[model samples]
Target: MLRFILGLVLVVGLWSAAPVAQAQNADIEATISAQLEAFKVDDFDQAFTYASPTIQGLFRTPENFGNMVRGGYPMVWRPSEVTYLELKETAGFLFQRVMITDAEGAVHLLEYQMVQMDGTWKINGVRLLANPPATA
Candidate 1:
């Protein structure tokens, strides 16, 4: 009887967790979509809105952030398609792994950190796939 009750509890727990998971994924996708739209139209201000607060503090201004994305992370600056998969939690924050295809048809793997701030999921950090620098 105890084992059966435990099993029931586990099932109920997982079922209740589903909506939160789905909402998280939806928020991530919406964020990427908004950022991509801003990039396409060269709307730096709107693009800045998608950035996590930590990111905003790092770059200090939208122009600098925009410049970095345009220069350093070129894939993110000009993504043609963004697909998200597999959300994971790390240290009380949610992380999303996504693959973005750039205008040049190159694929880039990116991980986005999502956190709850003011009752909404906001992107906080982005990790690019590691790549060896072009050695001269």
Candidate 2:
């Protein structure tokens, strides 16, 4: 009876947590989508607002952050298409995978590290991942 109760508790706990996780995922995706829209119009100031305090402190200003994106992440800066792939939590951090198709038709996978600050989701960092080799 004790084992059955414990299993029941575990199942209930997981079921209750699903909605919260789903909400978090939706918020994270919205934040990224807003930032990408800003990037599309070269509105760095607006895009910077989605970044976490740590990233803002490191970049120092919107222009600097925009410059970095333009130079180092041109695909993100000017993506022809963007698609959200997955959101996963590891080591207490949430990472969002996004697939971007550049103007030249090359696809790039990027991981955006996200954090919650004052109940709002902010982008903490972004890393470009290497593409898997063709299986042909």
Candidate 3:
């Protein structure tokens, strides 16, 4: 009887948790997820849509931009356990900081400088930081 009750409780818990686990991504998470998904599918055109105007000028072609992201930053190209750490406003624009953990358990801190033009936040640049000490 005790085992039956425990099994029933576990089943009910999992059933109730499904919705939250599958919930829609928040604004910041959605932006990052969109970019990642685009890159994963090799859709540079779709990925470029998220870039700020300044970024567009820096890398005119999708190939150039994708190459920069893939080769220069292999950590970001193949990252796991990505988490949005913070979103802070600077001057009149907003900046987001995302922390990514690689397959080898290395942390890659990325600073996504954002600017809101006409109400939509666009990523202007990505600054990769050196991995902090394990204690950090």
Candidates' TM-scores? 0.87, 0.89, 0.72
What are the per-residue Cα lDDT tens digits for candidate 2 across 10-98?
99999999999899999999999999889989999999999999999999999999999999999988899888898998999999999
List lDDT for all candidates, in order: 0.81, 0.94, 0.76
- Please give the clash total of every predicted structure, in order: 1, 0, 0
Model 2: CA > 4 A from native: 1-4, 133-136
> Among all windows of ten consecutive residues in candidate 2, which has the lowest summed lDDT?
127-136
* Native RMSD of candidate 2 (Å): 1.7
Model 1 CA deviation exceeding 4 Å by range: 130-136
Q: What lDDT does candidate 1 reach at residue 58?
A: 92
Per-residue lDDT for 1-136 in model 3, tens only?
9999999999999999866434421555676778877877778788887888888889998888889888886666677778887776788656677888876888888888876667555778888877656783
Q: Which residue pairs show collisions in model 3? A: none
Residue 77 lDDT, candidate 2, scale 0-100: 89
Which of the predicted structures, 1 or 3, would earn the higher TM-score when compared with the native? 1
Number of clashes in model 2?
0
Q: Which residue runs does candidate 3 get wrong by more than 4 Å?
A: 1-25
Between the candidate structures 1 and 3, which one is better when assessed by lDDT? 1
Write one digit per residue (lDDT tens) for candidate 1, span 1-136: 9999999999999999999779868877788777878887778888888887888899888899889888887788778878877888878778888888889877778888887777666778789975324445
